[model samples]
Target: MKTMNYSPEHLTSNRHLFWIAAVLGVIMMAPVAWIIGLSLKDNAELLKGTEAVFAMPYTLVNYANILESSSVFGWFINSMIVAIGQTIGVLLLSSLAGYAFARLEFPFRKTLFIIVLFGLAVPEQAVIIARHQMFNWFDLHNTHIGLILPNLSSAFGVFLMTQFFRAIPKEIDEAAMLDNASTFRIFWKVLLPLTLPAQATLGIFTFLQAWNDYWWPLISATKADMYTLTIGIASSQTNFAQSEGLGFLGAQAVFASLPVVIVYIFFQRHIVTAVSGGAVK
Candidate 1:
């Protein structure tokens, strides 16, 4: 057995790092805390000034108003549908493409992967006009499919899944082959289960991206009935300049973020594992 000792200087360095991290954490959380505080305060009080956030007499009127709004509820449902739809699509397509790219031999495989990677460099704005025109031609506008379709073929998802799949040992596949397991079976039963961490990471990111997406939904879902949470929330803001509804705006921000927070709470362990590159054990 081996023993290790930490010197006074090492301890001092660790202490400094702890304080630095604590300060940075506080800096990052300050805006979130401010928003939450504002959401609890009265709109009129907030109109007087943001200083009311630090005072007493907090209320839930803002949240009450949000809950009572039927349009907000519809928007929330739209967001959920789009986010879940897109996440599942991205995961399925990306995993299949990744498995093919990593494990199968096919002509133009490398070239095709290179082209897909090129998509990562191409900003969405560059092709937005063409995409919109095509979608218009297909009459996909103002539809849930319109919002979900654009993100289904995810280049980043493909890249991440491919790398994760490649990191897995090929011997597993070879052994499965010896047992006459079909390719789809090998992938579905043997390999896919091992990639749970990567799937969790990809699913979380895809859901978050779809949930927060505003620009595409803003243009595509022009109708109020079709609006996602982001567009709906923005449209609900009666006035931004005068802070006419400051507390409501704050509440919307907080309300919209609750889903993401809940998701993190449920999957934080898998997220940590994926980030630490432990997907392959």
Candidate 2:
């Protein structure tokens, strides 16, 4: 077989596209770089306007103030509880729901799944008003339980796991059945192993969602001590008769962003593999 070589024009066009993409990537990253830069700078420099914003050297005072004086650490712990709790909840509930939907026969199952899919389209923000009233009625407001309740059943998770479960071979189920395995036994012993990639994918997604969830936590949390990172970040900026300096606020932002970023950096490959595995086979 003979291979056809690219014309000079084609090579030039490809190079042009590469350079364009590189330029666009840099453009998109500008704000992230600026935020990171500002996080290391001092308030005296930040409030001094544009010239100071650029002129000030980076410092760790912002980090010190955030750690020493702020309630940031408490918020970090609160965020961990909510994020981990919600993630575990989603993994448990959604996997069971997804498995049942994919493998089991039941009445009105398709219709029920469709309704659940409809639930996906309902915006989280749109439901906050009613949810707040219900939370208050249940006396769940300002509690960690309240922050977690609204997240326990996740539509996206159900859908993702459902699709991935369907992709698994039914022959595996039949083989397990031939061995006299109960449905639950088969699921735990056989099917679940096949879906680890999907589980990881779901776990990461759920963690990120719950970790970064701002509005739900904000509405559900009112007590200063009950505050998660999102609520704490907002609260960090102001209180009765006091305002946090811009540098301190910048540090709060950096602190809030760091953990998630660290998780991504370390487990990025696993996340990618899991997602790709789920998507492919």
Candidate 3:
């Protein structure tokens, strides 16, 4: 077979696109790079200003100090419990509700779904007082359950799964029915397995939201021991700033962000496809 060569114009266009992407990548990563440099620096080097940001004689002392003094590990555990709990709850409830809304016929189904859609526009802050009062009444304040309750099932997740389920051919359900499969059986066995991309997308979104949630946790989990990673980091950063300097804060910040970055790296492809597929629908 003969090797085909690109035209000069095509080659030039490709080169231009490559440069543009490289520029954008650098712009995005510059701050993160700076943060990493700052985190690695000693207090003496940090005091020398921006010129010394990338200078040598870096040390891991900042990381060690934060790890030693702070209850970051406890915060990490609390956050993990809340995030994973919320993600699982959202996926389970959203998938079932979504399938029902998409496939099953029930009285007031449309009206109920319309109400759920209306929930999308309701800001979380609007119900803060009510939620707080309810949680207090149930004695759930400052607890992980309280933190996970509000996020258990989001309107967006329900809507997303509903749309995706609708896109699947109804014939599949009918065929399952003919095979003596019940409604729940059809959903669990036949339909849900095909919605992996949507599920992954929703799970990632839920986990990130729960992980980074600051305001609600701030209000609910007021006790220091109950604080999530975000809240703990903010509080700890202040103490670190006063005693250990900004380098310590940078190290803690990096530590706080590692889980989210790792999650995105692994599931980024599924996220893209889920978004684009939803858009195409």
Candidate 4:
């Protein structure tokens, strides 16, 4: 085979784009790395040497305090309950709704889908007052049940799944139907596995959103025991004051951010691939 050479313009364009991406990657990773570094340093070290950030002595005291002694574990469990529960809820319900919108012949599905799209723009903050009152009426305030209830369905999830569903080959559904597979089975056994990447993508997003949620949980949850890491870290600051509790605050913030970092490190490529495939289709 003969080698082919690119024009100077083409080579220049490719090089420019590659360097731009590299610069962006560095910019993004820098802050995250800095946060991790700060987390490792001791509180005294932190306060005595803000400018000596890179040179400070490191300790695991913060991590230990949050994970082992503080109410961090309780908050962790509560966050998991809301995050995973909401993620599963969104994936399951969204998958079914997505399949319906994509494959099933329904009346006014387009209008319904358009309405659902509005959920993407709807901020959780917008309806918090109403949501709080509703949870209060149901006696769910400060419970994990209350935390998970409000996020049970997501318009974004449904929209993402719907887009992915439309990309699946219609032939699979037809063949499944021919074998007497019910709608439920077809969605569960046939289509769902085919959409695994998208599911993972959605799951990661759902987990992050739930884990980082502060405002609703903060206001709705009146008790300290029900605190999430988002609120846990904040409460720690308020309890000790930011200047007084720099070490604990930094440590807790660092601790809270680790899971998401680990998750993205592992699942990032799958998410990118899934999203790319969805977009291409």
Each prediction's TM-score against the native?
Answer: 0.93, 0.90, 0.91, 0.85
lDDT of 1 at 13: 93
Query: What is the per-residue lDDT of model 2 for residues 1-281, given as tens digits with 9 covering 90 to 100?
Result: 99877999989999999999999999998877776777777776666563455664779888887778647888999999999889888988988999999999999999999999998889988888998999999999878788887988888889888988899889999988999999999878888787777777788878888888887887789898899998888876665123566667777887888878988998797688866663436
- Residue pairs in collision within model 2: none
The segments of candidate 1 whose C-alpha lies over 4 angstroms from its true place after superposition are 238-244
Best by TM-score: 1
Tell me each candidate's RMSD, in Å, in order.
Answer: 1.9, 2.5, 2.6, 2.9
Q: Clashing residue pairs in candidate 3, if any? A: none
Off by over 4 Å in 2: 1-4, 238-242, 270-280
Error of 2 at 218 (Å): 1.7
Q: Give a tens-digit lDDT track for model 1, residues 1-281.
A: 88776999989999999999999999999999999998898888887888999999999999999988888889999999999999999999999999999999999999999999999999989989999999999999999999999989899999989998999999999999999999999999999998888898899889989999988998899999999989988986766536437888888889899999999999988778867867635
- Arrange candidates by lDDT, descending: 1, 3, 2, 4
lDDT of 4 by residue, 1-281 (tens): 99777999989999999999999999999877776776677777666656545884677776777766647778777777888888888888888888899888889999999999988889888998898888889899988888887886788788878888888889999999999999989988999888787788878888888889887788878898988878876776765544535666667677777788898899888667766764325
Give the CA lDDT, 0 to 100, for residue 107 in model 2: 100
**Overall lDDT per candidate, in order of appearance:** 0.91, 0.83, 0.88, 0.80
Worst 10-residue lDDT window, candidate 4: 238-247
Q: Lowest lDDT 10-mer window, candidate 1?
A: 236-245
User: Judged by lDDT against the true structure, how good is candidate 4?
Assistant: 0.80
**Between 1 and 3, whose TM-score is larger?**
1
Alpha carbon lDDT of residue 92, candidate 3?
98
| Candidate 1 root-mean-square deviation in Å | 1.9
TM-score of 2: 0.90
Q: What is the Cα-based lDDT of residue 10 in candidate 3?
A: 86
lDDT of 1: 0.91
